[model samples]
Target: MHSIHNRLFLLFLSCMMALLIIGSYLYYRSTTEIIHDKIGDMAEKNISQTAGLFDLLLEGYDSVTKSLNSNYELLRLLELRDKETNPAASANMERSITNILGAAFYSREDIIGIHVVTHKGKLYNYEKRFAGVIDPGFTDTDWFKKLKDSSGEMVWMGLYDGSVINTMQKEAVFVFGRQLYDLDTYKKIGVVFIETDPKPIWAAMSNVTISPNSRVYIANNENRIIATTEKDGVETPSFSGLPRPDSDHVIVDKSTDQLIVAAKAELADWTVFGLTPKADINAQVVEARKYLLIVVLLLVVMSTALATLISRNIASPLKLLIRQMRQVEMGNFTGTVNVNSFEEINSLVSSFNRMVHRMDELIERITLASISEKNAELQALQSQVNPHFLYNTLDMIYWMLDERENDRLGRVILALSHMFRYSSDWQEASRTTLRQELDQMRHYLTIIENRLEGRVRTEIRIDDAWLDVMLPKMTIQPIIENAVKSGLEPLNRPGLLQVYTRTTQRELCIVIEDNGIGMDERTLTELQTALSDGSSAIRGNEGHVSAANGGTAGDRAVMKRRGIGLPNVHRRIVLMFGEQYGLRIESKEGAGTTVTIAMPLPSKGRKIDEHTDR
Candidate 1:
């Protein structure tokens, strides 16, 4: 590992050295190639710009020619003139032609001049110097001569100006002209012409820039080299550049051979070219490698330093911590953990000491609590009345009856038996199997029915599968008692009471509904108050009403008067299963009430609790 680390560092240095060497070469190549590539990209971008520019300029030129050619009204009057007979009338027609000419050039700054040539073998123009000429030798000027000679199709002359009569006003420019013919006669009437300046197109192409280093240029397909750049104006054919060698786009570098070129076609037989240097791409790659080598070296050096520091500072503290943890594992957290090497290690020791202190404080509290709890248990034991007192009292009564009054003894025995047996209340957590709660509820119901036999009707409906369900002790008996007491409220009129157990959505639902003197909202509210308060169960000696609703006394009482049941079974269920499976009370005044208790279905594999049926 040591040797490899040494070799790795050396390899790192050597690789960096090699990268520097290769990068130096690549950078050199990239830099030179970048210049060439830049020029080519510039040239290509310029080609596109130039093509767009050329089209825009062609639009202006075409509009000028169209404006002049489309004036068939002017052409119609001129074609009616008698050339030899009324020469003066021809001069008057020439003035209207000049007025129309000025309108064509109004927005077009690039059109140098415009003119019209009538087909009566008379050269009629807007200019005074060139007006009213009878070239009655019938077609001598090349523009007129060509229109009369052709089959009268629209004509576009490439680049010429001698087609006009005036010699000096014509500085040579591109010409666009077309013939006007009468539809019926198929006869040539006159020709319209417009001159276009190419500088407008060049001006539109001027802002072409491809890259910071790139150069942009355009060349005529016929061989005019018109190049524009960020630092240079339109390049003439005499500028230092290669001739466009027939190919649409091909890179050629005078400084170096690496090049990328793009070409676009412009209007009027013009081809635009863009040049890009190949070195720009290589330079970016080499620069990336140069950055990569720095990152690797920093990682190597930093890792070695961090690993050494971690071993010296962190590993020792961790070993000490492992030993301390073993003592804690052996059940000894009384001693202090020691660390002074680093802040984190010191923090761990401080935390360990604090935890040990907290445990000590907890142990002390627990010891005192255990003593208090024992005292409380002893006090509770003292408060419990001796069961032997009643047993002795009953024994005494039976003994007396055996001696003399046997009738009184039998009556006394029955009363004493019921007092202990029927009033036995179990704790909450003890589970009561469904069958057992039902039996207890049945016995309680029998007692209630006996009291209100002719007044009310009571029914119990239980599912067979639910018979084995285990619920908390005393969950149903209170409900049965409440149903009877509340449902048989008046001495005369009575209501129907129904108890049904079924399964709904994975829960056992114990629904107790009453059609009794269905409560008013106010009475129902009092019943609700009574059911909620366990303390409200015993109101000065009528007997204890187990809190059915599990609410405060007032809320329990409000529900108590109306609920027919305080929903105590609902509370016991939620206490056994979570709060999610709890009481849902839906009641309507003067109609009926449904107190639904939902409990979770126990898992099949759980062991049966010994106290389940209490």
Candidate 2:
């Protein structure tokens, strides 16, 4: 015997443990998804808004360049060629252009310097100190070439050091350039370059990042990083792995533990990438998981302790019962178990005490009646064999052979003989493999079909996998007999019988269904009541089985003549495999009836014994 306390404790613990594990997994998964989605949405919104701000800033600078291009005085000065011959006229034009450039520079506090490079290699600069210069090599610079090749569109030339004229100012500045054209000639004459302090743009990007380690940068269509916010780590933000700028707003790259959100600037062919680490984005989820794990562990401990106490309380009564059982096994039937616990356990104790008392009394009288009772029981067992069925079957076979003498008659005789021999040969064991049982049922079905003259059709649809399982002998045959006699025989139309098998995680099921005259509601209720009444015998008095089958007097007599009924089969199954495995019946008045025999899968090397008739 095993310790009932431990079994109870483990059962409780296992149930709670499974529930906790499943619940925790679902909670963690949902929380992580929610956190990821929330962070992605926020990141996308922030990047989009920052891109808008950056575009507006660029547009403002473009407007300034357009205003300068339209200045009549500045246009005339650039078109003038006599500036080299007339120093007075050249000096006046240079001062006038300087005033115009200075007025545009002071319009925005962020503007650092503005320089104009003419196609003739002449350079003009306007800055905080107005230190102008005329550098001939300005046309050879990359920024100047980019501006000249820009056609008529404004070009943002990324961040660069201070201009040549204002080399003393070491601060970095973002430069915008455009090619200036002579309106009347339709030819490019000069390039206008405007530089702005990068502090404001950097501030916009910095405000868009939520984490300290996060990076936000602007990249061209070629994926070159133009500018980025101040970064503390060596990890450089790359836009090459991001999705197309017109696709989804955010992309989560779990491989790199990063979430990237991107937006395209409308003013330029530049994309803004905001990269945030997953660890930082899911920080709350991580903390929640940690606390949930702790709580689950604590709950496990508390539940275990509680289970121990409950199991002890429940096991106390069972332990008392076992002690009494042990005493009885030792031939002392005077002792009885008495323990107070649940009502069910208390009832069990009461029944056990009553049984012991009865056994004690019976033991005193056993010697006086042993011989006579044994002889009577033996005679009853021997008489239990119903000779009428065999006689009728053999007589029918004889008549059929004598009258018809066809292959059909021969087949019926052969099937009947096989069924008789199989049922009578009880010398080997009470249990048989499911395959053998099915074979026996096949023989019985063959005989029934022949007798019914093709009025009955049968179908068997059981999986071969469970054919090797062991079950009680005569388990399915009796149910089939009941279906044929009570359900099918009375039907006016052709009858169909089906036998199939199903399996669950723990139990195997064999189902027998018949399209015959079924029982009404009242008869079914009474039959079900009798089945559940904990009785070992099914009574023929209530008409529960007979009425359901539309039983005639002859059918009732035949049923009574046989010693077994559905109840007997149910009792045997319960005795062998506990109450969890047994027969279930479902029936309708006009349709048919289905009977299910549920059993546990047999373990390896385990043999089940058939219970004696009660």
Best by TM-score: 2
Cand. 1 Cα-lDDT? 0.54
RMSD of 1: 23.4
- Residue 384: error of model 1 in Å? 99
lDDT tens digits, residue span 329-350, model 2: 9999878786889999999999
Q: Write the per-residue lDDT of candidate 1 for residues 278-344, one digit (tens) a residue.
A: 4554456466556666765676566556555645565566667777778877878776767777787
Query: On a 0 to 100 scale, what is the lDDT of residue 188 in model 2?
Result: 75
lDDT of each: 0.54, 0.74
TM-score of 2: 0.52
Top lDDT hit: 2
Candidate 1: lDDT of 321?
Answer: 72
